[model samples]
Target: MQNDFWQKMWASGVVGFHQPEVNAYLKAHWHKLLTTDHKAMAGEVLVPLSGKSLDMLWLKEQGHDILAVELSLKALEEFIEENHLHRRFSIQDLVHERFCGYELEAMRLFCGDFFHLTREDCQDVVAVYDRAALVALPPEMRADYAKHLLEILPPDTPMLLIALDYDQSLRNGPPFAVSEQEIHTLYGEHYQIEKVQEDKFERKGVETVESTYLLNFREN
Candidate 1:
């Protein structure tokens, strides 16, 4: 998706994609991505294309550090303002021309293009929680998004991914439909994919299927 499209969405306040609460799928199935002993995982959890989702705060409350990236500064600012987080967070330099970083006690938010992030920038990320990123992209961009993730993340990094599937002919999408086969085709070569759950629901009278996946790096 183009940066301007997202900027316009924020500018116009047409952000239906913004969930009012932390996603239920994240709440219900996040434990599956944890270790057997049930301890909180080490390192920061990366949230790509993060758009001021409350899930980051929820993840921090669970004793995980968060590293989130978004393209819109307006959205990030709204996050801090809406959550009353401005008092606790500080602005910082990302050492990049196009990116700005904000840091709280346990979370970092970068306002910039996610694709501009380098592997070194993500060296501390241990896992991923992708509730919105993958499904937001068009088909042509999805491959690039997945490829970029593989390039930047450490080997064997586990991800909790939530995707939506629906008949595209029925509706135009920013929350695009991504099927099971496409998920496999994108990540099957490198990640051990597990279908954790599937739910069917109606959105705007259109039947939608939402899927959750636990993805761990394939063993060498």
Candidate 2:
């Protein structure tokens, strides 16, 4: 999908993939995936395709720096304004427009295509949080999305990934159905993948399964 696809999703308030709170899976497994090393103080965590997720704010409060990237400027603005964080930001244009959180500089949001990100932009990223990003893409884009994650982050970067498995016949999706097998195919070579937990639930009357994985990148 093009950038306008997401821009329109935000503009039209059709962000069903957008969660109102920090994702439950992240909250449950974040400590296990990310360690509290003093070295973590020097690096930031990466959140790709992040659409004004409150989880970024939550992570910032946990004392790690955050680098969140999104396609929609409207979503970014709403995120800051809605959270009453508007007063703390200053902007710069760095390929992607950069929104720097002033008080602690704990949060930095880059607004543009996530695929445009380079290794330098994420060189200090020690961890990743993929609540909505992976499952948000259609099947065709998922491989490239996986590749970009591998290319951008340093080796062995810990990741918490949440994905869905369901009948594609049931729905058309930005929140697409991504099987465990697909997850293995896409990221298995680069990451030591583990299925940590899963839950079965219904949304809009369709049966769905959500799985969470812990991805530890192996030596390249």
Highest lDDT against the true fold, candidate: 1
lDDT of 2 by residue, 153-175 (tens): 87678888998888988887868
Q: Per-residue lDDT for 1-220 in model 1, tens only?
A: 5888999999999999999999998998887787622334656899999998999999988888989999888888898889988676664545556578677778788898888888988888888999899998999999999999999997778899999999999998889999999999999999889998999999877899999998887767
TM-score of decoy 1: 0.94
- Candidate 2's C-alpha runs over 4 A off are 36-42, 88-104
Best by TM-score: 1
Estimate the TM-score of every prediction. 0.94, 0.89
Candidate 2 pairs with clashing backbones: none
- The lDDT values for all models are 0.87, 0.79
